[model samples]
Target: MVTYIARRIGAGLAILFVIAALGFVMLSINTDAVVRGILGPQASEEQAAALKADLGLDQSLPVQFIQWLGGVFRGDLGRSWFTNQDVNELIGLRLPISLSIVIVVLLVTLVVAVLLGLGSAYFGGWFDRATQILCILGFAIPGFLLALILVTVFGVYLGWAPVVGFTPITDSLPGWMRSVTLPTIALASHSVGAVAQQVRNAAFGVLNMDYVRTLRSRGIPEWRLVLVNVLRNSTVSGITVLGLQAVGLLGAVVLVDKIFAIPGIGEMTINYTVRGDRPAIMGLILVLTVLVIVINLLVDVFVSVLNPKVRTR
Candidate 1:
């Protein structure tokens, strides 16, 4: 297990380095600065040369990469070019907000999806048909559009909650939850449908296995026969849905955060990208990359646990 985890971590690090190199190259070239130079508005040639030297932009790409990699190893994520602030500090402030929203959305999506999906599987006909329709409808719409629709009906028309801004859960859990509820729902509803689809597939597959027949032949209680052995076999696929749902929740969270006006890393990222704020952009991108890497690593571990043969492999 240790060896397996180490190998995956090493691969993730290598990918991170490649992405970092690309982002650094883009920033070092500073096309905006080049455009400005061509336009001849700000800084003289001598001043520009001095600025390049100070920023180490004149260094060879290899040397710059080495320095950036070294700083990362030492827990120093370099200063932002657009803002003088430290990248780590900025990430520290914003990551919690995004994480909190993700956690809430994940829980709601998981519980609702499992209950509805399992019920649909256990009780066929009308229940199954209704669930299938919901899954189709939810999966059909785009996340951003769904969020806007929800905002219109739930926020604008009903006036149940505030439209935007994240109130810190640390300061007030109830207030924060109220502000976040609609956004979480908008972000996770489609994910629930997706997860339900996977659940239905997994459960149906489990129901056909020889073990299920064996239990049925033994005259096992009908409820226990369906719930215990059947559910266990389906869990691996259900876990696949859970992981996918959580991941889907992340991107949609960005859109949902925008619609609901939540103050999260996604919000910060949008602002930076819009204004071409290099430092903030780099910081947010790296933070997001780290999060993806971490969650994917967790997914691998989960998959292995569900099937021990995977661990041996």
Candidate 2:
């Protein structure tokens, strides 16, 4: 198990390195444009040259990459080109907000999806039909559109949740819950359906397995058979689906954060991208990449724990 986890971590680090290099190359493509955007049109050539030198853009690409990578390893994300604020500071302030929403969405998705999937598979009647219909609709609608609808109904018309702005959980628990609830629902709406379908399919396959029949023939309690044996075996697929959904949610939160005025990394992403703040944008990309890697790593470890066969592989 330790070896398996170590291998997974090594692979995750490799992926992070590759993604970081690619992001740096892509973002460095228009160095002149970045300098111009930072200094504005009226700035002299000498001013632009000095700005480029200050930002280490005047160095060779490899040199700059090495320097940036070193700084990242040292926990220094540099500073915003425009505001001169520490990129790490900005990310630190916003990351928790995004994470809070993501964590809530995943938890809700897991509970609701497992229940729906298990019920549909076990009952095999109207419940199954309704779950299928909901899954279709979930796939049909986009997350952003769902976020908009949520904002309109829950935030605007009903006044249940505040339409704009967020309150940190550190400030007030209830306020934070209210702030995140609608956004969580909007993001989880689609994830729940996808995960539920995966769970239902996995459960069905498990139920049909020879071991399940043997356990039944051995007079195992129905509830224990379903909950212990069936549920545990079915979880691998659901977990894979949830990991994919988590990555998708990282992108989906951009629109949801915008609609709800949540001050998360997603909102910061748009603001920096639009302004061409290379440092801030690159920092955001790095943070997001790391997040994706960590999430996938965690998923892999969890799957290995639930299925010892995975560890041997």
Candidate 1 per-residue lDDT, tens place, 1-313, comes to 8888998899888887778778867766654464344335766777777666766667787897787778778888777655667888878988888889888887887778877777788788999999999889888887788778878887789988776777898889898988888777777768888888777878887777898888889999978976677766666676777777676666666677777777777777776665555556666666677777887788788888767677676
RMSD, every candidate, angstroms? 2.7, 1.5
Clash pairs of candidate 1?
Answer: 165-261
How do the residues 106-199 of candidate 2 rate in per-residue lDDT, one tens digit apiece?
Answer: 9999999998888888888999999999988888998889888988998889999998899999999999999988888889989999999999
Write down the lDDT of every candidate, Cα atoms only: 0.75, 0.91
Q: Which is the leading candidate under TM-score? A: 2
Q: How many pairs of residues in model 2 come into backbone collision?
A: 0
